[model samples]
Target: MVKGYNYIVNSFFDYLENRSKAVDSLLCVGLDPHIQHLDKPSAAAARDFCLEIVDSCAKYACAFKPNSAFFEVFGAEGISALREVISSIPEDIPVILDAKRGDISSTALAYSNAVFQHLGADAVTYSPYLGSDSVAPFVRRPEKGVFILCKTSNPGSNDVQILESNREQIYLHVARQSLVWSKHNNIGLVVGATDPYALTRVRDIAPNSWILCPGVGVQGASLKDALISGLRKDGMGVLITVSRAISGESDRAAVAAELCDAINRERESRKQNHTVHVTNNIAVDLIETGCVQFGDFTLKSGQQSPFYIDMRRLASFPDVLNRVSKEIVKKVLDLRFNCIAAIPYAGLPIGTAVSLLLNKPLIYPRRETKEYGTKSSIEGVYKSGETAIVLDDLISTGGSKFETINSLQKVGLNINDIVVLIDRQQGGRKLLDSQGYRLHAVYTISELIDEWLAFELIDNNQFILIKNYLSESA
Candidate 1:
């Protein structure tokens, strides 16, 4: 086995991300030794064909995907050749076996062994149609990666993937469910580049997850368009998979190098063109959704204020809620938390959206414990000694958070971090820090006010009022 492959298997995505940066490419080379393209229809010919491709293009490749069906056609010899090709890949480059295997849990376990142990693939793609049990075996090995087929590149994908469930597309449902299944942080989505709309929708739902996008070249998908629609804010989550376009070329290495350069150029262009800050987008959405209102208002703490931020309105605007959730997910990605603990009332919707996006279990402290049933102080399933990251719409004096924190601690849950959409700059962070907890906010109240003023959404008087209010409170 390659050195440290076993050790790094647990963090396959991290390995892939590092490899992508080292090579400065998101190109995932596809090794499909087609019978017609081979000199002879034999396993030896297939092995040689792939070895040449790897030897020529390994430096330019972020990862290599070998379609198992092409090799499996040759039976035992083909399987042997497949193993040889994977073992020959460089230690840093991840190999994804496009097996698309789907079966019951027991049968899936055997399949996992064959692909991960026998063939030695770093990751494998499988169908999620059979539900979680069928996929349990593959994802159970947290070190190994699994990509669930979401929106495929094929034309017929629309027949079923577009079907609506609860007013949302089936593919989107899979994207949401993929988050829940990614508790190990080892799961990704396989989205075809041919459908940029589908790719965009998937990106919106799972902004931080790695998406393997096929159909970039011979399949007639535009690489630039796919990157524009599918790339994460950091510009590193989308992998462009190409098979015939690179392997079929006489000068494979040159084609691979050109493709890599082209992809980088597009990434750079997107970065340059992305002028609007993420918080700016949220600020506009907040205004349009009426979450942020100006003029005289009474604060919950009985203090008079020139404006009020009613984040509860987010639940009424699903699109705005989704956009906000995506940003929150980005902040939560680097934190260590067993689940989410949303402060009740305004925090529930925001927390629920964040929970769905991060695939983390969500629990909340009810304002009043129900007298009937279990009468538990906290809702949702959780275990003692687990860390909980507190979620809320906004934080002001940091007083309300302690109420929920105290309730959570009463149940033996550990609280180390709190995330919110906006920090009102009223000593909330200081209060939290003094209490042995960290606060993470997507935007400070001052930043939001500045954004609104810059966009001409708020007048100078309104901006000044909010700014003074924040300063006085601080």
Candidate 2:
């Protein structure tokens, strides 16, 4: 096995973000299986065609972005074949469902479930024009991922994305506004490699965000130049998508290998590039990740709750983790803690990402430290009496937070503040207040519901049900 490949990659984002490093390549096979490219009209043949390409090029790919339109054209049978095609992909390789779907609230959510749950897609492409309500369902399920259509390599993309709006190009506004929807930090943008202006501007707006660059093959984008403009300072940020260039070749794997090596060489040629500031739209991200849910769920309190909240889903999204860490870094830098600690189970990734982002040390609290390894409840180095901020993904009854906080205090790590992604408002805030600690959160349940109502994601009865439940629970 390859060096990093020996270890388990847990999520779609983790695989795509690290595969380039693991395999030393960034070539992603774009599985656009047009019927014209095949000899038989059989759905099984189409499935076989994609499987062959994957078998040929899977080793060279960081991910596979199969345009849903192609499979969609085949109707029900084609859809079944698409599922088989998706299942055929290796577990460690992320698949992006390139379906630029955009609609409002619950409708968008149904689409979100279709892509992430039913289809089992690791990530999907979406149009952002319907605004936050339309995108929230996708963003809310932040464990899965979304590549918002920012700028494309096609000729007619200028009709809207590039047109001037509010003294700026519409695409920049889209890039800027995306952060608001990326709360769980799982958001990415799609910019065609052929569009130089967009490639440059989007990076400026979302410096730390990943840009999926298409239009590299038959679309005539300069791969070298696109990499130069698009790569993050680490040279690994952008996903360089080369579809036809590799697919049309007689030796598809050979072509992908060559392109992979070329892209790696180009990225290495410019390692000094700086990373960007990342911001997220928490409501959208939380919803996309399935951290926030509507309908009946029984709470640990023995009461039925209308909404279920959990932010552990955030760990699966590398892009969202990066953005959330960047946001947390901004808040924590001012606090100037000597180290960072996280409550185990959910907050581990968020805390680790923040620690790396801040260049500080990290320690995670175990429910009980391993009897085998240092026999201490807390792992990692920390000085006694040193200050550290706590990271957790959500606060419901504050049941988990207090336990972890007490453990941190026992170690002499002074923590008077805790940061979380969501404040469910079901006595979590008051519980912290009673303890003389402040709760900092990216979004509260009230804010999320308002967004849902505004976008008509929930009807009056549904909205009233949620609000009244929270009100009574409070």
**Quick one: best lDDT, which candidate?**
1
User: How accurate locally is residue 221 in candidate 2, as Cα lDDT from 0 to 100?
Assistant: 84
lDDT of 1: 0.88
Write down the lDDT of every candidate, Cα atoms only: 0.88, 0.78
Our model 1 lands, by Cα RMSD against the true structure, at 22.0
- lDDT per residue (tens digit) for residues 37-147 in model 1: 999999989999999999999999999999899899999999999999999998789999999999996788999999899999989999999988888888876768999
Q: Over 4 Å off in model 2, which ranges?
A: 1-12, 272-474
Worst 10 residues of 1 by lDDT: 1-10
Q: Candidates' TM-scores?
A: 0.59, 0.56
